[model samples]
Target: MERASRSNMQSILDYTDKDVRELHEQALENLREIGLVNPVDAFKALSAKDSKGRNTTLLEIREIYVSPNVGTEDRELSRIITLYPEITIEGGGQYSQLVLTFENNRFPDMNRIWQILESYGKESAEYRENIDDYPMLQLTILPLTLDGRYGFVMSSPIMWFLTPADPAEEQPRQIRMLIEPGGLQFVQDESYSVEKILEESRKMMASYKMDLQRQLDKEEAEKEMQREMEAEHKRFLESNVTNHTFGYDENTARTAENRRQAWNDMQKDGKFKVGNKRD
Candidate 1:
């Protein structure tokens, strides 16, 4: 079970509105590529238009928690998400929550239910700022694993967002996977127990963090190297330069002055005066 935001809870708490909007656009583009209906339309159609507490804009999938009962007798696969959506009220107009499921069959392409919580509001710029605010919906998938069993959730290091789709379209588009690490295939290593899976995830996260740190360190070193080079170059120029402009020594300056004086004297010569005359 992968709790959304591996860094997300932090991001949700820290991201500015502009940050949120950028992420929202990315998710929508991804969904469009896969032929998924515009999340905005799907969400609006399924939700009560005038109803309070609707996710009108910006939706971030917090986590994709899949519990594989690897060693236990109960092979139940538990997949849950916090803020799971609500189904539309029948006859009254069924439009409520936006649930994305992946089906393993040709039934409807995918049949797996993903519980998405409503928090983002583009018009209002609203979101669940509190990471712990579990409003309790259809799918409140949390991290879980069994003893000795192991599994891991492959998620984006950079959080993703869903927003109304339309650089030009009037409607909002939903769902996009942005800035994934190497665009690696999404996976959750199987585990016999929730503990094992959680442990595995932790291990993988630690490894990823180390790699990120190394990259940051390398960039810093490169910058430091460049600064040293620039400083050395500047110092060399400063020490080599003479007091006179263009690095001319006092002797060179006197020589140039002498040459100028000679030319002026020649210009004043009586024999050359007539030829030098101009209208």
Candidate 2:
């Protein structure tokens, strides 16, 4: 009986080892889903010093424009949206307004801020797993600078390759609107065209723009109120506090008297050398 049990265990091990090659390939696919695709490329893409690293490419993009200081005013610059007329597999996606803040506290009002994010997104887009299927994509440049480094975040709704690839015989369809939970699993509709996707993307962008406009309005109102309050305070001080009254004249007289006394004493002291002033 012990011999039979040993034989059974040996047979189980043999069966498990039968298709190691297929098992290895499946394991690699699973590993890719969890994100660790070309670790060397990913690491080099993120490295600030490695410009011409192995198996990696660098794309330099710069945004050149003048925007009104949103801390004070809003301009028509943010209203410009892109429809992506030339839609490449790697290039064209319906993107919302590219809102850039033009202010002095940040970079100068009209300086080209380098955008190296295309290379970053190209390498790192695979890691951005979808939280949900609802897509809201925008290329936003914030008015902020620190330690001479201005940066941007690579954002997308799916873990997609942003760079162009060799045209495939059949490309995967765009993510369709799921009416209910797990709707995608049950349905595979082929009706979602590029135009439809662009239309939906436009709507999403419009909604985002409205929300942003409201926020800008609120901020402008607050700034106006603050400026008014500051002006009022200045006016009040001007009316109430005269130079001759409120001890202002007395303080000035006392300071001048002390300085004059110091000068007289220094003049009398023959030993008051210039070197002594340092001490």
Best by lDDT: 1
By TM-score, how accurate is candidate 1?
Answer: 0.27
Write down the lDDT of every candidate, Cα atoms only. 0.31, 0.29
- Which candidate gets the maximum TM-score versus the true structure? 1
lDDT of candidate 1 over 1-279, digit per residue (tens): 122223321212343445435434543453356353332333233332112232222122333322233453322222222112322211113222222221111111111121232221221133244332212111222212112111122233223344334465443233332333332221222333323333344454456456546766877787787777566544433442233224345454355454344334434553222221332
Taking the tens digit of each residue's C-alpha lDDT, what string does model 2 give over 22-122? 33343344335635333232222222221121111111122223223345332212222222111111123343212222112122111212112333344
lDDT of 1 at 260: 43
User: Where is the poorest 10-residue window by lDDT in model 2?
Assistant: 141-150
Residue 130 displacement in candidate 1 (angstroms): 50
**Cα lDDT, model 2, residue 79:** 22
